[model samples]
Target: MIQKSFCAIFLFVLGLGPISLTAQSLEIDADLRARFEYRHGFNNLFPDNADPAAFVNQRSRLNFNYTTEKLQLFIAVQDVSIWGDTRQILAVDGNDSFSLFEAWGQIQMNENWYMKLGRQVLTYDDERIFGGLDWAMQGRFHDAALLKYRKDGFMMDLGGAYSQETDRNDGNDFRIQGFFTYKALQYAYLKKSWEKSSASFLFLNTGFQDFDVNDVADGVSYRHTTGTYFKFPIKIINVTGSLYYQFGKANATTDLAAYQMSLEATYKKNKVLYGLGLELLSGTDQDGAAKNNSFFPLYGTNHKFNGFMDYFYVGNHANTVGLNDFYAKMVFTTGEKSTVLVKGHYFTANAALTGDADAYLGTEMDLVYTQALMKNVNLNVGYSHMFASESMSLIKGGRPHDNTNNWGWIQLIINPNIFKADLGTPSN
Candidate 1:
């Protein structure tokens, strides 16, 4: 089966020869990455294990690209596996399998028009709300089609996707989205030298299986988001601020109307950088009962938010107790080849109307350092410590005797440019 699949892929590439020849261009590029990670006190979050432990994981990826005058193609595959003692405890399916990460094709209709089809990563505005989540071992992807139009400082996007509905035995699901943005730095910010400032609006509509087995109704979900960001230089300091608002509804019994908002400020000077942020989620106490608030983390990448030991999202516990995060961060560069980062966060549990008015609190501290070993090699080490309040600990099923949780990891990356040949820039 593997051999057959390989042959099919090769044939598809060779079939493009006619177009490549007419364009009088041929270019190919590839990238390979490997990483190893170790974690301590990783299993304490699970109910079965409260003791500290250690484990290792290895991951690898390969990417291919082909470009012509009016068309482009890309594909990537990844494999992740456990190593040493970790394999014994976290046995995965199919003996460390490999899967397709991305497979997409783009066609340029004109200088300002393009269309893309197949699986790809969708990222916008610092990857806060719509992101690729590239930091994780297994990145996120969407199987969809996208169309984009650009002219001067104006842009527009439209996309849609469908997935197999697990709740419904019929295997039917649906998704649709539309987005628009306008950017003008010179007019909006009055700063001609600064990068562009822009505002975006997105509308999403999705359908899912009904909860009741016999119900004829199809669950429909809707979401709307608006966001903006600006960059300006004051004296020797470069500053930026970003904000977002999301309103949406789902089939869950909880209030369908939920919202999230956040504000971030950062300053950079010389080799030092500092940042501060605040995020809040509104509480919903409808039906005179405990109402759960929706927390989307739209403006903040949940994957990058390491507080709570990454237990909520990683363990699928985010639906339970709500989260409100406050954070501060700093970074310093050493010479030109190394840098260090430190961050701290405070978390509080939101109150549901009928439930406890005051829930819990937690704190997290993180430290990381990165060094360039060579032109193509780099190393990173990180440590994190989490302290949960009594309220949080109890709800999380943690024993009162347990005061804290800790985790650490080390990684190495090597990327070398194997081939580079320009096939002349194509004119669309």
Candidate 2:
């Protein structure tokens, strides 16, 4: 297998020297990322029973694209692994070490209509409720079909997906990691943009497989989520906000009524950018057998919110008392190629707490500095510190160990175009 991974600048080196005037194009895109991380306390304060961990993780990918007047095709292959695993990775089976990351095709139905089907990534707006989650080594993709329409300043997309009833690799269809995905899904997304502002609306439905109580009834849990994300600029300040509501049964037996809200403002002047924001996700009432009020941003890029340490609402924070996050952030540019970012966050519970826990959760501080190494290469370093509270300790299900204190990391990113061939009349 060949993998072309690098920055867009590398594409120039892979371009074909000669072309026809047929207006057809073929291109290759590659991304190579390697990161080494060391942590005494990465995700949470380790509970004394665990030790510090370190690892070097990397991701490599190569994608091919073919485009014509009304037809398009794409295929992406990828491999992700830790350093020193092995010189030769066996990929005949379904594993993260090697796989087809994406394979999709698109057809233009009319002047403003298009349809796409296959394994692909879906992202919209600020990525609060839906996203690709590219920061992870394996990233994220869905096997689905999407119908799209675009005209002027407005766009619309409708998508649907279905998975097999089990995890076994059957005669046809991929496993989809079984329990990790829904059995069925449907969604609609719409967006409109003006000169200085933009807004989006989305509605999603998902159903997951479950075990029946008596092994004789239906075993599908269904949920519905709807939301809006909007942004506008007023004078020197930019304002952005998002709100979402979740309803319907979380399972055949559990009823849910949950929601989320967030708001932010930013100012950019001279060489510095400053911002302040708040986010709230409703939690289940401790006294409730009536309904579940804990919100879950199912497909969102959870790693980007709450805090960089990802202590809450990433994966395991579901159905529990949710969170309230208030934060302030600033970015300073030094010279033309480097920038520094600093942020502070105060967290609490959106609802009541467990045990004698007060509403006060904790505070955290994060810092990062990034520099461009070259056209398509960059370097980043970051550090974060978390101060745990009684409520946090209670929620974490452990005594507040001295561990939730600090964490640090460094990463390198390089992307390059590996090859390009053109046909038809060249724009140049």
Candidate 3:
């Protein structure tokens, strides 16, 4: 019934299209993106003599916005597909890779308060713990209702969501049995900004539902993750810091306890910028069947951190052992419209090591350049190389290290506004 209610509300807003046309209060938004990616040793620890794979991924979106003085109705739909995955000339479900990206309505209660409900995306802070993950071909979104408050640079948001197995056919298992991300999520974000400094905080909780094998019943588990980020400028150098902790009962019925901390400094002189940073995450010593000490970023844009190679803490290695990343970077402006970035990362495990395992892991270097083409088009190319030590190989599954681990990719992004209709102001 709840799902049906939400669907009805969404459809009702969509049905307002005719009214919007008559009132001249409709706005249309569209985005078309196609990127070609080539992967080779991008994940490291490749098989023996592996070949590179290249593919083109595309994402297209259509959005409708009807705005009034007191309320706003927004709906966004998208189609994502891989090149040549389906027939181009035929129209079938195989070629119908479409989904509702965002559907929401906002009620502006006053000048400083507003409430938004329905399926939407939550993006906050430096995208550390909460981000939209726009780097991926499909991107990321959430089904949540958000309450927002803003006055000047100070902002606060409190959002929450709950999920259940709504498959009516399975009448028996239709309710919440766990508290995982697929089950429930709640969070609060707060931020304040000054002239040259800013601070933000996040409190996130996820509940997982699981079925009890012995009791033949279902239950939910909850975990809590919280963090704070702060940044300030001192003379010519800028500094940023973050601290996070994770606790509560894990989905697997293990006691959760972990923490992460980071600090970074950047200096800019004319067209050149220099950066240095260090990050550490606590880990569980997996010597035996011990409790979990590893922390998870949960719903974060992990691709932006550690390194672009996505070697550490992004996938597969989650909740395994903690990680420590020490890195440096340099950015140079080629001209008025182009820039080049070069970075190096040194990685190691944070947990205690066993026999034959050392702390010295490996090093990675990344080089990227971006140049603007047209007003709405740009070109981006990047390459990275990873040099692994013997200890690194052991920690990273001990794969083949005879060949130089390398990855290269180039991307072109074109953004053009397709349509526009403004009722308030008409242009000549």
TM-score winner: 2
Query: Model 2 over residues 1-428: C-alpha lDDT tens digits?
Result: 33333333235323533333346777887788898877755566667767777888888887778777777778777889888775556543234387778889899889999999999999898777788888787888988999999999999999999887555653323334342378789999999999989999999999876555565435567799998999999899999999999998877788989999999999999999999999999997444447889888888788888888888866667788888999999999986999999999999888787553588778989998999999989898999888877677756767564565677888898888877776565454
Candidate 1 lDDT tens digits, 1-428: 33354346545654555454434333333333444444443423333355555545555655556677778887766665555523454434456456788899999899988898888887765565567776566777777778877776666777766554346656343322211111100001111122434545444443333434554435644434545544555665555555545444434354444455556677877898898886665444322434445545432345665363575444344444455678998999985899998999887754452345445466778888999999878888888877666555544555452444677778777666554455443344
lDDT for position 284 in model 3 = 67
Candidate 2 whole-model C-alpha lDDT, 0 to 1: 0.81
Report the lDDT tens digits of candidate 3 across residue range 201-311: 988888776667675537667889998999999888999999999998766578888898999999999999999999898876545335678887777788888888878
Task: Looking at model 2, report the run of 10 residues with the lowest lDDT sum.
Answer: 1-10
Give the least accurate 10-residue stretch of model 1, judged by summed lDDT.
Answer: 182-191
Cα-based RMSD of candidate 2: 4.7
List TM-scores for all candidates, in order: 0.79, 0.89, 0.88
Q: What is the overall TM-score of model 3 with all chains considered together?
A: 0.88
Candidate 2, after superposition: displacement of residue 216 in Å? 5.8
